[model samples]
Target chain A: MAFPPEHEIHRRRFGRNIGVAVTLALFIVLVFALTVVKVTRGDPMQAFDHSVRPELAAEEAE
Target chain B: MSDIRAYEQPGEAGFGDYVQLLKPRVMSLVVFTALVGLLVAPVSVHPVIAFASILFIALGAGASGALNMWWDADIDAVMRRTKSRPVPAGKVAAGEALAVGLALSGIAVVMLGLAANWLAAGLLAFTIFFYAVVYSMWLKRSTPQNIVIGGAAGAFPPMIGWACATGGISVESLLMFALIFMWTPPHFWALALFMKDDYSNAGVPMLTVTHGRKATRTHILVYTILLVPVAVGAAFTSIGGPIYLAASIALNGWFLIGAWRIWRRDEAMAEADGYATEKSVFRFSLSYLFLHFGAFLAEAALRPYGMGGW
Candidate 1:
């Protein structure tokens, strides 16, 4: 049996490509949402202090 | 150019092959130990950040696995156990594995630094380097004590996870490191005892291949004996509690018994039972690690209610 044409194969796989893109986009969105929640709901200063700033930055900010 | 062009075909690396390159089994262990490290720390981390940090740590582990596969493709090709691996089996190209490893290593380290602390990121980087370069490229092919030294690479994940939360190292994390580092030799040597032919065929100098099964068995008992103090001692640390202490005692007791049994067995008896005791010990070692780490998590879970720790 003969396979589909090369372009036909490519056209058929476009759906999968779209699926991959959508999945990737959703993951990015989820990460961004989590970051936003963490920064806003959690202690933004404490997070920033521990991860980014110098020692005792949270106390200094307080 | 035409002749060279004819030699290459588009590689058929499926998603599974990519995952195989990551060595998901090893990554799962890394993730578990790292999670324990993060959770058991005294410092509180934002839940989202904790999750992100573990994700990056797992990725760093995967990167190490991929690079190891890329570098060990030659040796892997000859070993029955690893001959069918993605790189050795011709499912994935060495260059592609290297690229993926390098890319993920960079992403995991930098993103972890942003999400957690530089110390954790630095530890993760060193883990990848130690596993990929120091262990796979150098020690693996050099000596019988390869696993003994290379075990440090595996031992660092929990320390990295602890660093993610605490932003520094502590005695507790060092004890966890010691637990894995000391446990690695006997655990692997037990398998080496069973799979001696694989190492012999591959020309890899496992303790079993280099020093013989008798010496390997003795070494297993010695390490297991040494491991007893480290495991029991962790019970007194900040991460340890009543639950952890109980788990450690039970686990180490069984582990010691298993090691002792393996030590006493002659090659004839092992061959008669098809190395049943060695196999059992090998399998038990896995649960030994899991339960020990699980105890850490249990203690962490109990701490908010004030039931954990001394």
Candidate 2:
């Protein structure tokens, strides 16, 4: 079978590239949002303390 | 110019070529080390934040790789080993690589700063700069000790990872850095021993090219000897434990034996056997890094059960 016309091929390639770039950009934005929530509200290091060394968590709690 | 033009066939660049520009092999190592660093740290991060932080750090690594490819395209075009890389092969344009690198660098840094702390983000930024600007542009062509000094760029991942979790550097993180740093010279020189011709043809001042195979052999053994203590010493750190100590001992023993074999072989013997010893050492070096880092991951996993660390 023959391929599509040159312009059609170009359009397809352009569309694919743009789609990937947009997906990646959106993912980065989501990560940024999650990160802000983690920093401001979540106990990022609390899990670490309780999980790695329970004594530290008890100390902090006391 | 003509050499670069040789690879410039009349075809449109593909997305895979753009991915190739990121040097996924190098990026994978960066990601793995950073993950180990984060996991083995004393503080725990939320799983989501951990995932995002690793992703951003990986992007930073890929960004540096793209920039290095853009800058090193000229040498890469001439080197047999690197001739098929996206930029050097003309599958991707240098300007395009620069744009991708800069864009990713900014995104990864800003997002990491938001997700983690400024210290981790700042270290990531410095790592990118050191690899792209300091190593690729300045050290690579200028010194035979390029891999020695440039090794610092690759050695920063675990430190950066630990910093992401704890927001500070510690003895544990520095030990991780030291393990990678001391491992670099021997690891790379083993490859150079087999691929000296590529460096010579590319006009890069590799130790094997400048110092000759004899001195390169000696240097490999010397660095390997120096690396042993650092590798063993890390087992005593907060991030280390019995499993890591056992793994480190076995791996270092194997590595030293390989280095000894490499040191004892002459040029004629190496060529006669097709550089078998050198090639084996080079292949082994890859596993060496993976296993050491894997041990750290194991220790981290064991810690939750109270079986890891001192």
Candidate 3:
């Protein structure tokens, strides 16, 4: 059966949106997992320090 | 009653239209990179603040997407892949998209600064400008290297996330940025190889159209090769671990193979085969980046067990 023009357009639009939404949901899950790992396991502040201030690591060591 | 009849019928805006405004596809990449940055950094933001920071970053990404849609409505009208965007499809006015983009851009930068640090906020602001002005307005139509240079704007989210955590930039975050920067060319070139007609119709000078498909394919393979060292190198950094190294090796190997497959296919064969190699490369590129970033999270998980980063 042929769908109405407006209905077909809406359907196509909805399908595209669902595709984008699923991609986004997957991304959120990935991000959350990363945040949990960092927050729970490592000192995020220290990680930041080492990340941003590498020279500082040497100075501190000295 | 007579005056009411004079008013034009307003088109209704659907939920899907709003989602289009958020540019969910682009937001996904931004969110992933930002999360990695937040996770790999040495600083720890409060959980609530972290969430808020990411939300703002996503909003900023959406704002950039909206502005891009607004400015490119002319070209987007012709391209098959983008012709159905809200503005081009007539679902949303260009003016409205512009307003939403500007408003969200301001809100995201200010809120990110309030939630995290000014450095992160500043980076978000610069990213928006780079995307909206440098890539969308200037480079897109002017050169074939649009994706090459424009990719930098897309690569900044992770660095901003890192900044939010550490309140500054670092070597590790730069390395993460470099990985995405290098990966963007091959990832986009693969799509261009198959979608050559779209760029041609849109009057956009994509590499495939400007330089030919064979050249684009060669460039894709070269970039894919370059991406390998950057991805593998990250595994040796403070954020790297056994899990990340193993995952990077396996994923990058498969990715190189996919690139090789794309490079090996002749135009006639690719057309006869329905561009299967091109399509596979495009699909794999998406998963490849996700898996690489996901590996970082896995490494982070193993850290407590002393199995991560040398």
lDDT of 3 by residue, B41-103 (tens): 777667767887898899999999999999999999998898888898888899989998998
Summarize candidate 1's per-residue lDDT along B227-293 as a digit string, tens digits.
9999999999888989999999999999999999999999999999999999999999999999999
Residue B75, candidate 3: Cα error in Å is: 1.0
Which candidate number maximizes DockQ?
A: 2
Residue pairs clashing in model 2 are A48-B44
Every model's TM-score: 0.88, 0.88, 0.82
TM-score of 3: 0.82
How much does each candidate deviate at the interface, measured as C-alpha RMSD after superposition?
5.6, 4.6, 7.2
What does candidate 3's lDDT look like per residue over A1-62, in tens digits? Answer: 98434544455557767876886696577557656655775443453433567756766788
Each prediction's total of clashing residue pairs, residues at least 3 apart in sequence or on different chains, is 0, 1, 11
Question: How good is the docking of model 3, as DockQ?
Answer: 0.05
Give one digit per residue, the lDDT tens place, for model 2 in B1-310.
6534534455556676777888898989999999999999889888878888998999999999999999999999999989999887876889989999999999999989987889999999999999999999999999999999899999999999999999999998998999999999999999998885899999999988888999999999999999999999999988889999999999999999999999999999999999999999999999998999999899889988999887
